[model samples]
Structure formats: structure tokens, C-alpha cells
Target: MHRFANPGRFLRLAGAVLPWLWATALAVTAWGTAWALLYAPADWQQGETVRIMYVHVPMAWLAMGGYLGLGILSVMSLIWRHPLADLAARELAPVGAAVTALCLATGSLWGKPMWGTWWVWDARLTSVLVLFFLWLGHAALVRAFDETERGARAGAILALVGLVNLPVVKFSVDWWNTLHQPASVTRLDAPGMHVDMLYPLLVCAIGFSLLFGAIVLARTRSAVMERRIRALEMARARRADRPLAAAPATLAGD
Candidate 1:
């Protein structure tokens, strides 16, 4: 992990891996979408509407997974002072928030047909909404301070603090009576979902994770380059501000 602290090395590694990541994500997502929508059998209960699960479940997983990543990065940044960690966390926030919003939106769309409503105060839904707000709050905090270091520290703290919401989001369905169903793919004994539905979902989840990684790496690399440029410009300006060395006094005798 410390090896990746150097932005140049990280950038090189990212460059090498990005193409493969993007290709895998695209290929898997395409295959999963086709399988989920076209070939997978409809749910016995929900029928055609269950197709939305492919997109919704993956987005929800990534939404929570993204924040979990952010929290870990924040810890690395704050405790170990990892140079790239804060940048990665900063880049990840918006992506997590976007996915969280999509989760809510798709869940709502799925709900309207099955639950007979577009919105609900269910524990799972409410907790996820809180997670989304936490992401927004972290983003705002990261930009709020005039000093970048201060902002980063503040954001890191916010991120760590917000981790309390993660378990709530994960276990809300079990802890409270809600319209949302309990865990399907994750179970102590065995997955509740059928193999037909589960396979495509697993594929889609992997694709989403890859996509998230690619986006974060790209954004972090951009941030590092921008910071490097700013540092160079500052160096140039400092040099420009210095008085030109006094011309050496000419020796008339020479």
C-alpha cells in the first residue's frame, strides 16, 4: 500500500490496469444485462419487474461498498498520512453519492409496482438515504476549507464518523419490520435467490465494482496531476518574485 503512496508510481500502475478494468467492466455489464433482462426467468412473484433487481441491487451494493472504501481510505489518510488516500477518498465521494441516488431511484421504481408506492419510510430505505446524505456532507466538507489540508482532514474525520451508518444500512431490514426484504444473496446457510437470478447479479456486481475502481483511479490520477501542476506554477512564481541577481560588477581594468 505504501508503494502506491508515490503519485507517479500509482499513476503508472493505474494506467496499466485501467484498460483491463474498463474492458472487464464493460464486457461483464453487457453480458449481465443481457442475461438478466432477456434470458433469466421472471420471478414467480414479481414477474417482469424483478429485472430491475440486476441494476438496483448492484447499485445498492456499490453505494455502500463505495463509502466503505472511502472510510478505509480516510483512516489511512488520517492515521498513516498516506498521500494518495485523501485524494482517492475525495474522488470517491461523488461516485458513491451518484450510485446511492441511483439505488434510491431504482428502488423507488421497483417499489411502485410491487409495494404500490414510489416511496416509503422503511428502515432500509431511510438508512440508505442517510448514507447518501453523509456522502454529500463529506463532499461539502472536503471543499469547505480554504486550506486543502484542513479540508482533507475535516473530510476524513467526517468519513470516519459516517461509518456508523454502514451497519445500519446493511442490517436495517433485519432489525426493523420494513417493506424491504431480508438478505437474499448473503446468507448464513445458503443464498435465498435461485442460481439463475443469482449468477447474473453476481456478474453485474463485479462489473459495478470494476467500474467504480476505474473511475476512482482516473479521478485520483487527474487530481495528482493537477496538484503537481499547481506546485510547479507556484515554484515558477516564487522564482519570478526573487530579485534578479545583481549583475557582477564589471572590472574596468579588465
Candidate 2:
């Protein structure tokens, strides 16, 4: 892990893994989408409306999971001072935010028919909304300062503070009287969702997770390359300025 910490080494590793990640993400997501929409049996109660779970559930999972990853990155940045963690977190924010937004949108769509409303202030929904806002806040805060280091530090602090919301989001359905259903796939004894729908939903989740990883990894690679290019350009400019600065001294010596 220490050896791989070098930017050059990480870039090489990402270069190799990216091609496979991209291929697998595309293939799996496409298959999962098809399976969910075209083959999976519709719900007994909600019928076609239940199909939204294929996307919604996975988005929910990713939103929470990705924030956990962000929290880890924040720790790395603030504690260990991991060189790449800040950049990785920066790259991860928009994607995480997008997935959370999708989760909210799909949940609303699913709720419309069942609850007869497009929006509600239920505990589960409200916590997830806060999660969404936290993601947005981190993203915007990280770019707010001219100095990237300052921005990263601020973002890291914010992420750590926002970590408190995760537990609230997870347990809201259980702890409160919410319209949202209790744990289905993650129940202690057994999942409440039928096996028929469960399998396809799991596939969609895996695909989304893979796609999320691929996107973040690709973005981090680009950021590293751009930073390297800027360093080289600055070095070149400094070298070019040296001769101009020395010209008067050279003339006086002559």
C-alpha cells in the first residue's frame, strides 16, 4: 500500500484496471436494466410501479455507501494526510450527489401512486434529503477557496461532521413512525422481499456500484494528470524567466 501510494504507481494501476472496470460496468448495468424492466415479475400490490425499486433501492444503497467512503477519505485526508484522498473525494462528490438525487426522485415516483403524494416529510425521506445536501455542501465547499489545500481541509471537516447523519438515515425507518417501509433486504432473520425480485435488484445494485467506482477512478486519474501537467508548465516558466532576470548581471560583468 505504501509503495502504491506514489501517484505514478497509482496512475499505472488505474490505467490497467480502468479498461476492465469500464467494460464490466457497462455490460452488467445493461443486463441488470434489461432484467429488471423486461423480465422481472411485477409486484403483486404495486404492479409496474414496483419496478422503480430496481433503480431506487440501488441508488439508496450507493448514496449511503458512497458517503461512508467519503467519510473514510476524509479521515485519510485529515489524519493520515493521504496525498490522493482529497482529489478522490473531490471526484466522488458529484457522482454521489447524483445517485442520492436519483434515489429521491425514484422514491418520489414510487411514492406517488402508493402514498398519493410526490413528496413527504417522513423521517427516512428527510434524512436522505439531508444526506443529499451534505454531499452538495462538501462539493461546493471544496472549490470555494482559491487554495485547493484550504478547500480540501474545510471539506474534510464538513464531511466528518456530516457523518453523524448517516446513522440517523439508516435507522429512521425503525426509530420513527415513517411512511417508509422497514428493512426488506437487510432484515436480520430474512429478507422480506420475494426471491424473484430480490435477485434482479441485487444485480442492479452491483452494476450501479461498479459504474460508480469506474467514474470516480477515471476522474481521479484525470485530476492527477492535470496536476502533473500544471507542475511541468510552471517549472518551464520558471526556467524561462531565469535568463531574463540574469540579463542585467551578465551585462555588468561583461
Candidate 3:
């Protein structure tokens, strides 16, 4: 981890891994989509509409997973003062927000038919909505201050504060009365679904996870380079602004 904390080392490692990550993400997602849409049978109740779960579930999982990732990165940045960690956190916010939006949109599309409404204010739904707002707020706060460090500190605090709701979102159906369904795919004992459906679901989940990893890696690399360029430009500007001292006698003569 310390080795990766060094920008030079991280850049080297990223350069080596980027190609494979992109390739694997593309291949896995293609197979996963084919398996989920073509091979998996329609649900008895929801019929073909249940097929939406393949995309919806993975997006929901990634939305939560992305926020958790940001929280961890925020902690690392605040405690260790790792610039790279801050950069990673900043870079990941938009991606997480996008995933969260996808989850909500797809959930609505799936709900209109079954739930008889485009939206609901159930515990799980409300909590996840709050999560999405938190992501947007944190991203905004990160850029609000003129000082970058100040902005990062504010963002970190907000991230940690919002994290308190994650567990509640995870167990909302069990902890309180809610319209949202309880854990179906992941249970204390075993998953609820049969292998016929579970395998493709898992494949889609893996593909989504891989896609997230690749995107984050690429975004983080861009952030690092942008920071480096900013630093260099600032240094050059400062040097240009400084007045030249009187040269040494020999140099002045030359």
C-alpha cells in the first residue's frame, strides 16, 4: 500500500494493469449480458420484466459499494493525509453518483409495473435516495472552498456522516416496515434464487465490479496527472513572478 502511495509507483503499476482491466471488463460484461438476457428464463410473476433485475441489482450493488469505497478513501485521506487517496476519492464521486442515478432510474422502471407507482418513499428507497444526495453534496463540497485542503476536509466529514445510513439501507426491510423487499440474493444461510438465475446474476455482478475498477483506475490516473501539471504550472508561475537577484561579479561580467 505504501508503495502505491507513491505517485511514481502507482503510475507505473496503473500503466501495466490498465490494458488488461479494460479488456477483461469488456469481455466479462458481454458474456454476462448474453447469459442474463438470453439464457435466463423469465420469472413466473414478473415475467420478462424481472429481467430488469439483472441490470438493476448490479447497479444497486455498485452504488452502495462505490459509496463505501469513497468512505474508506476519505478516512485514509483524512488520517494519513495521502494526496492520492484524496484524488481517488474525488475521482470516484462522479462515477458513484452516475451509478446511483442508474440504480434509481432502473428501479423506477421496474417499479411502475409491479409497485403501481414510479416512486416510493419506503425506508430502503428513501435511504438510497439520501445516499445519492450525499454523493452529490460531497462532490460539490470538494470543490466549494478556494483552498483544496479545506474542501477535502469538508468532503471527508460529509462522507463519514453519510456513512451512518449505509447499514440501515442494507437492513432497512428487516429493521423497519418497508415496501422494499428484504435480502433475496444474499441471505444469512444461502441465496434465495436457483443457479439458473444466480449464475448469470453473479456474472453480471462481477462484470459490473470489473467495469467499476477499470473506470476508477483510469480516472485516478487522470487526476494524478492533472495534479502534477497544476503543481508544475504553479511553480513555473511563481518562478516567473520572482525578481532576479543581482548576479555574481563573474557572471555579471560574462
Candidate 2 structure quality by residue, lDDT tens digits, 137-233: 9999999999998999999999999999999999999899999998899998999988889999999999999999999999999999998999999
Give the candidates in order of lDDT, highest first. Answer: 2, 3, 1
TM-score of predicted structure 2: 0.98
**Which tens-of-lDDT digit does each residue in 164-213 have in candidate 1?**
99999999989999999999899999999899999988988887888888
Q: Candidate 1: deviation at residue 221, Å?
A: 0.9
lDDT of 2 at 95: 94
Whichever of 2 and 3 has more TM-score, that candidate is 2
How many clashing residue pairs appear in each of the predictions shown? Answer: 0, 0, 0
TM-score of each candidate? 0.94, 0.98, 0.94
At residue 215, give the lDDT of candidate 2.
97
Where does model 1 exceed 4 Å of error?
A: 244-254
Give the alpha-carbon lDDT of every model: 0.90, 0.94, 0.90
List RMSD in Å for every model shown: 2.9, 1.0, 2.6
Give residue 250's lDDT in candidate 1 (0 to 100): 35
Q: Which is the leading candidate under lDDT?
A: 2
